[model samples]
Target chain A: MANMIDLIEKSEVTGDFPKFQIGDTLRVFFKIKEGDKERVQVFEGVLIGERGGSNKRAITVRKISFSHGVERMFPLASPRIEKIEIAQTGYVRRAKLYYLRDLRGKKARIRERQDYKKGKDLSTAQVNAAK
Target chain B: MTMGIMATKLGMTQIFIEEGVRVPVTVLKMDPNFVVSKKTMEKDGYTALQLGFGQIRAKLVNKPTKGHFQKANVEPTRFLSEFRVDEKELANYEIGAQIGLEFFEGVLSLDIAGVSKGKGFAGVMKRHNFAGFPASHGTHETFRHGGSIGMRAQPGKVLKGKRMAGHMGDELVTMKNLRVIRIMAEENLILVRGAVPGSKGKVVEIKVSTRKPKALPGVGGATLEEASKNPMKASKAGAKGAGGKKK
Candidate 1:
């Protein structure tokens, strides 16, 4: 009987999103509607956390602008999100990169992973194949 | 005083509409309700349809209950409930027919009744929402007391129906005018807009609301299918033009 509830949620799940980890930097292209006109806006930030699962999945993105930290959450399955692009991957052991909030200047920088393009290539290739 | 359907409360979850706004919804699974018997005005002094739900094993059925099902020419069910209907409305249902989710087609709101979760032997503060004694200035061990029942000279004794608490919850509770969010016929699920009365898996009776209906969340009162497809016009974030930005 519980499977019936899952069946309803499964229909709303979006499968086109590219796979990205928590410490990776992503560029999200989001659609914004203004006065009968729609435009795409870019928001680039580090993926801090991913919450929930299935159709309710959301991602927390943290960025620094003008020496101040700004955090934003977006529903991963929302139709308003046009696309997600992995900018840079970081080598981190934590599931949530919250400890970076305390560090600033050079200390706040994330260590770049050497072999990150392989995973991004595979995920984007799979997304293209699905389309 | 109308026909209703019995369903099990599945759980609650959040679903995002097309406009990227999240809506909290409670899921209900509707099983097949078999019409076990029909009562007529002249024969039973009232008109009603006796519906049965859930499946029961053959060996667990008692003789009288088995004979009752045999007389109705229907398979035995675990639970049986009756819904009173108008004399003219009785013609729409038969003794052995099944009721489906189509019975609630075009309904925008519902009244769901079920037994609430039990909280045994509660105090006045928890049960009746009473403002108990002040918790300072020598108030000790009597913070949860129900203060006063009546005036000193007026009525002398305590009032007959004073609000003191003993048992709480585990009683029939009816939540009225819950907005219907979505109905998935193929999955046998109905998504209602708010919290229901009981916990998950509890059987609840759902009926069309008797109160006046409210306008749906959309421009010019669009239907649910139209609102879902064009959620920007349906949600408040879109209706506010440029000022109402959703986070």
Candidate 2:
């Protein structure tokens, strides 16, 4: 399993991905191609969960549209992703913010995480950081 | 036309093509291989080329294997495999001549042959996929049994090669017509679509298919030419000054 991750990391492309966490709100700029044309589509949502490591890493984003909850899972290393903007950071106890799905309106709101600002933005640095 | 090479199964991964289509591929590391011997119809009653792959330590080479490599003036290899090729193409190859992933260039589909992972001693249900007896309702200890072997009194013993519990896997399995998704020639790595017949690190013999790849249009000679044109030249050039190995 670890070897699989190592193999993935070797092939995964590392771009300037934004630093965000579960329960945080993000605007993911995804590249969508149309008939002989390509455009960037912005998907704003609350980060529900994140799984896998390095190249195989993926994030689940959930957003409410017309009172209906919609969730989309995006691979972090996918080339279709143009950029990700961390609009707001949310304070979360659990790694996966799946419980947010059940809550509506006021209850769904996540507290803003203040501690994240104190640390230097690590994701911005182009260094070989492995987890 | 019998184009094949010996490679080690590096593992499996997914590559995103145009339009975010994730193609699952098994990466095979094709170590440098050399033609050890060629069997001609006049000499050996067959037209085949015996290729040696992976470097083996001189001490690890047996007496017979050492003699074989000595005769060819090449280093001992870990694995030796034979593939049938056309007699006319046999002249293109020479004794001790090297081959690698280059042979697989433009090969859209390939036949992967390897020893599947051994599943030890298994029962009929797991090994043969036999639907066992009911789990509940007085079916005690007969849960995983193969049930009735044959009709009453008709044939006393079990039929030969009957699907029964025994050793499973650890056998030579060939997965044919797998699409060749990517070829990293610098690393000697080949990415083939779909699952191969072996576990990670297993030695797999990859050969060009005589049959056409299913449903894939324009997968003939042109694809192989495109693959040979060094698609990864830009990527390899970027890493040259860093003193890093491609693999």
lDDT of 2 by residue, A55-119 (tens): 67899999999999999998987768988877776777888887887899999998876634455
TM per candidate comes to 0.83, 0.85
Query: In candidate 2, how many Å is residue B27 off?
Result: 1.2
| Cα lDDT listed for each candidate | 0.76, 0.74
What are the per-residue Cα lDDT tens digits for candidate 2 across B19-96? 465667687788888999999999999899999988778889889989998899889998888988899999899999
Clashing pairs in 2: B106-B223, B106-B224
lDDT for each residue of candidate 1 in A6-100, tens digit (9 for 90 to 100): 65566556546666777888889999888889999898998988898887888999899898998889887677888988877666778888987
Give per-residue CA lDDT, model 1, range B18-79, as digits (tens): 55556777898888898888899989999998988878899999999998888878889888
Off by over 4 Å in 1: A116-131, B131-138, B212-247
Name the weakest run of 10 consecutive residues (lDDT summed) in model 2 chain B: B234-243
Candidate 1 falls in which docking quality class?
A: acceptable
Quote the true-contact fraction of every model. Answer: 0.42, 0.16
